[model samples]
Target: MRSGNPRDTDLWEWCCGFYPGSHPGECSGGTAATFDQARADFEAAWRLFLANRTEADFQAWRDHKAWTAEKYRRFDRGERMPHDWRPGQ
Candidate 1:
């Protein structure tokens, strides 16, 4: 939530000539996107391909990199579902 928009992190870094700046708004993406939005996304997908998962599932989901791509795509779409994804508390 505090890492700034993962989407826009590089943009702000490029503009500021660095990643993290002194002001919270600079790197926190506080003004960029709602914190609630980011938090919701992260919590929804933190356990994708990990919970009750086997190594084969891990490979199928993450080793080929397609799953990583899918994850970001979901983030971009703000697609959060309770049955679709649920990170541990």
Candidate 2:
């Protein structure tokens, strides 16, 4: 059996935003063996990351609102109130 060559493997790193004056705000995963392959990988990774992050943020917001609602319900039911609480003051 023959061993595979390391140079035959396509390894790339993501690179972006290195201009002197203008910030292009553009990014690319650099130097793939083929442009199509690189673009496919980058776009897929970007979309997956975006979706996951957005979902996490939304879930956190929903949990916080639920906790606040529960606290307000307790106050309305006269279960407990803060020491600074006063009626319509």
TM-score per candidate, chains pooled: 0.23, 0.30
| Residue-level error in angstroms, candidate 2, position 55 | 1.0
- RMSD of every candidate to native, in Å, equals 16.6, 16.2
On the 0 to 100 scale, the lDDT of residue 4 in model 1 is 46
Tens-digit per-residue lDDT, 1-89, candidate 2: 11353767565444432222222443334546665767677777556544444454545556656556766988789887465644332
Q: Write the per-residue lDDT of candidate 1 for residues 1-89, one digit (tens) a residue.
A: 33544675532211211111123332222232565655554444434313434565444534335544566777789975334442221
The alpha-carbon lDDT assigned to residue 44 of candidate 1 equals 44
lDDT comparing candidate 1 with the true structure = 0.40
Give the clashing pairs for model 2: none
Q: What's each prediction's clash count?
A: 0, 0
In TM-score terms, which candidate is top?
Answer: 2
